[model samples]
Target chain A: MDLHLSERHLRFRDELRAWLEKNVVRPWREELRDPTASEDSLIELRRAWQKKLHAGGYLGLDWPKEWGGRGATAVEKSIFEAELVRADAPPILNFLGLSLLGPALIHHGSEEQRRRFIPPMLSADEIWCQGFSEPGAGSDLASLKTAARLEGDEFVVNGQKVWTTYGPWADWIFVLARTDAKNRYGGISFILVELRTPGVTVRPLRQITGESEFGEVFFEDARVPRANLVGQIGEGWKIAMTVLAYERGATALAYSTRYSRDLAALAHACREVGRTGPAVREKLARLVVENEVMRANGVRMLANLADGKIPGPEASMEKLFWSEFDKRFRDTAIDLLGPGGLLLRSCSEARPEVDWAREFLWSRAETIFSGSSEVQRNILAKRALSLPQEG
Target chain B: MRFELSDDQRLLRDSARDFLAAEFPLEETQRVVEHDPRGFDPAAWARLGEMGYLGLTLPAEVGGQQLGAVELAIVLEEMGRACVPGPYLDVALAAALLAAAGGRERLLAEIASGKAIVTIARQDAAFAGEAPCGIETANGKLRGRKYFVPFAAEAQALLVTTPGGVYRTDAPFAVTPLPTLDPTQRFARVDFDHVAERMAAADVVAGLEPLAAAAAAAMLLGVMSRAFEITLDYVKTRQAFGRPIGSFQALQHRLADALLRVESTRSAVYRAAWCLDNADPDAALAAASAKAYAGDAARLVCGESIQMHGGIGFTWELGLHFFLKRAKTLESHYGSTEVQLERALAAAGL
Candidate 1:
């Protein structure tokens, strides 16, 4: 197999490198690390970076130009992601909506819906959150209990959605609710609802990492118009599947690219701490080797994206790789950091020390999200291997 | 860039698979292991020579096919899958070093053609970047002892490292069985008292260790796939709780973790092979990193295979033990995983 990048791809990479050098705020990372700076300032910095990235035509690189995308190939998009990681750019603020919902909408949304919703998201003028997971429906998403009843032109919704990323900051939330109670999946509908609506309430849920990257959103008879439907009624399940496809494919790769860089830095730190003994060296070598594999696996999966949409089994394979690798890699870092790892993350004085202790805590949830390792495995076994459904 | 195999490489893999399936199945491999001193059938070794795989990496002038590391990896991967017993890894390594050292034209061709067998007499337990001390050259004679020597019972020539340089000896040497944890490959301790034929040009540790590490990693990839395939097959059909146990989430998740390891091993192996073939600046680092990962990769895959197969897999009749033993055996070859990791760290400038 050819491992060398094409001349055109290399050129694209160079151009993107130049753009990153110019647009990324100078000393941004050091400032982000300044423990005195408020988290709100960090959020604002990320938002501004997202705006600049969007203006630079970096977002939606694979989406059709008709939908305000750059019309880049899968490999080109992969290269963009690699460059972003190399440049140490801040995490994009609208990742959930941009990578998952934006693609799903372009695939399933009506022309009216697209025209009304696409530009605001592209500009980050309206942040979005997903309303899918509920108290009852964690992995068995089709069995969700969220219900919507039609009243004239509107659907009155009542449900509680958990793990809604960006919920606190979201201007809007794309909701999944059952329009017909008789069926688990076939009667479901996809609807978009305003987060600031009269009956909607948002509550942040703190994760083990001591930050609420996601939250829970409660809807009590929130009125959303029928026009907000993604497709016809009974299409929510299909639309959700589409969103998840992108989530586990290119989106996962983006996360992995950053994770690997962090891993490299940890390795450097390990070498600095005189931990390069046989056991430690071997552990670091394994991480380096496995990181390469994880990246290669993602690239292979990305190459197989059909019509810019990675299928369920392919995406599941990648999600399984990154989530598991992230956990093991970070834990290894924690062990390597040793006593230095014991410094609590909130202690600003320890920023000069390796910041891996925080990452080690954060990595625990990677396998729990975007489908837990169990769910991803079931998908791989049932769909990819054609195994019988586990009872 | 593509991560898939080239058209020719794919064809080579398919043909190797078919050939191994017909002539060197697991039972045949076990039979050869039990009955042969060389650890492989002489006839099969000749057949490999005829197919040009014995010298797959050598120059065409030396009667080899002159293929690169990817092809070598493809062949070795097939060999590992079938659990083929042989000194093929030794042969390939010796041929590479001899050619690199220069002025061993005749021996190179002989090894490539299967007319001669050569194995290492490692001065240390593994390739530890240092040759043994007290090696002396007196009146053009060499003296030392090499341990854990593979195929010493039948090798026509023994390659040894000394303080002066790498030396080759066709002179008589003593061979004794060194009991090993692996049944697939036999090992011996070869003692040399004034053995002759010093090859002044070769430096054994520098030229051969990297290739050896890369080959070991390639073989690990094979063991991983075979173990994964067997476990997947077993879990799919073996029923528990009135359903195929593969349907169980715990087993599924375990299988998924193993699958990830297998994929990671494949990636590392391929990249290392590519690096070696291209003579990239980072070839040594890639090889060490690959071997280190392969050590874990094989352990994880083979261990998972047994756990997935239930009690029957542990029995000798079942094939899981073969994979586990072979994987364990190869993990310490050339260098242990720990040693390889240290090499990788050193290469990374630690």
Candidate 2:
């Protein structure tokens, strides 16, 4: 029940903080602050920073040591994340691979698969995209229509995956397809396909932020090796659940920490600009509180995971809070910025826009992605509350 | 770091649930609502006291079980499920205030023995703008009005905070019972006109804020659980056009949304309670957030519970009104959702 971090954990936090201070260069910070930074520059800066993290043994702290990770404890991983955020490190393009697919592979992949995939993922030499969410199967994932048919030693896949973050640059994709359509959940199977497959195509969808960070990936007759299948055949739903847990739990921490830092920066920026209005102050204050609560909720969830307690329905609770809080904080930042918030960094007369406008637009997806708030609520009702499930 | 409840706490929760189900059912709640100063059965209070539930949060030295806030929240959820109306919230809050105020040996002892029903009047006219300070000392007397004092009509002693200090208003003070939205919980407007008082120098108001918010959050947790249950029952039984109403995606989505609110609110409330027991610095903000979130959730769930029930749910005879009244009343008590947001902002130094 105690919220204070242990002395050893505090020391670990200090060490990480010091390391980040030395190695985390400020180019990404400048890029994040300067909305004028070109998209290519931002992408390149993120990849280069991820390489620095790999060299520093901080990129995949929770992964096995054989996979080039530090093999750190949950506490250490949490500390690394907090420190990385406080240092304002660049976003990790390999997050989908390292946090989601890597863990899933470690638990469910073949030995050869692990040996081939883990190291490259840790080094950011390969970026991965998730293909669990199809155009039809969102919250009701068991109802997916994506088909993968076995043909000799390989499988031919055909489906459309929407909201594929960084799908355009991904070297590979981990997808779930219906291999046995009669069994519903049991009919599914997970497989990894190289993005360079002949029939694979990615079309980036422009976001409200004017950046196509996500894309709609279509697979038609995409051939993947049988060895790429994870776990047993027709066990894709089980594998997907494991990946979803890792994705939801890990990203909850990352997103909350990032938003907390963003809120702090916004507060400091407001103070520097001599924004004294009560509305501005009030909005800033609420964001601070929301950010703090989100942090605490993240800590509690991590604690549960560290203690070997399955996150269960409560993980969705954290997800719900994090997504909602992220939206609220970003919106509040935009409101506080007022007229200047609408101005882009390219506008010379703009009051140092600080990317708050871009961030606000991005935050709208918080509820839509990672299981819409509505879906999370349904999970909460049926699982956590033990309410009767409706047809 | 562990977020799961301890085995003892889980057992405590289960036993509390069983006790409420077997002893103080909704019928008892209805009876209390029909007759009683605080709109609760005194015999049921005695039964709970005998079960050692009254002093669940107090120290053992004061005839209590010395359980933590998590346990208190668990008990509160069960109480809310049964819709058991009483001065339980007021008593728990008073014990917390007395413990925080320090040097209240006699008062705590009396409270533990169930001989004294103590309540804190937080919403006083003078300290309405500040952190609920309401005790005053001038010519050896205390005079002020405490608004919306829960169970003031039945409370044996009142803990009043003022700018000068906190004071005990024992007797001879005017207590006027006010008609409230929730008949299950009674309220009164107390006017202290030069009442005899004992000054409590400790800043109990600040200490009591977190606990009060936690208790309110706990009550809302109960409200949500029952509302969720009622909604589920209605959706399962009530038929629409050749199907159950719950079969409709529109209603299912709304129910799911309501369920999300309830569960998240539960998490926030219990986490806040845990923090309060552990003395976390962020406890105040957490509690406020929980209160605001849970209060809103309870109101929404209760409103939807009635709506989802269709015509029967809207009737006064249907028992939905009991929960609806309590949920709506609790939304503004302790602190309004806006007040909590403001407190949270202030706590965050916004």
Best by DockQ: 1
Strongest candidate by TM-score: 1
Lowest lDDT block of 10, candidate 2 chain B: B126-135
Tens digit of lDDT per residue, candidate 1, span B1-350? 55678889999999988887898888776666667656778888888888888888888888988888889999999888877777777788778778777778788888888888887776454345655544555677777677778888878888887767778888456887886767678788777775576675445566667788989888888887888898898888998889989888777777776776777677667777777777777678778877887888888889989988889988877767889988998897778887786677667554
In the range A1-391, model 1's lDDT, one tens digit per residue, is 5556678878988999999998876545566567677777777778888889888989888899987687787767777777787787887888778887788789999888888988888877888988889988988888888888899999999989999997878899988899889977788999999988889999998987778868899989899888998988898988887666554455535765676567667767776777767677667777766665565566555544423454466577677777777888878777777877757756664535336667778778888877887888877767766666744
Q: For model 1, state the Cα shift of residue B1 in Å.
A: 2.0
lDDT for predicted candidate 1 compared with the true structure? 0.77
User: What TM-score, computed on C-alpha atoms, does each candidate reach?
Assistant: 0.93, 0.88
Clashes of 1: 1
RMSD of each: 2.8, 3.7
Q: Give the poorly placed runs of model 1, Cα more than 4 Å off.
A: A251-260, A267-283, A299-314, B126-134, B200-204, B240-242
Q: What is the lDDT of residue B208 in candidate 2?
A: 70
Scanning candidate 1 chain B in windows of ten residues, the lowest lDDT window is B125-134
Tens-digit lDDT track for model 2 on A291-347? 655665676777666676656776777777777777777777767767777776566
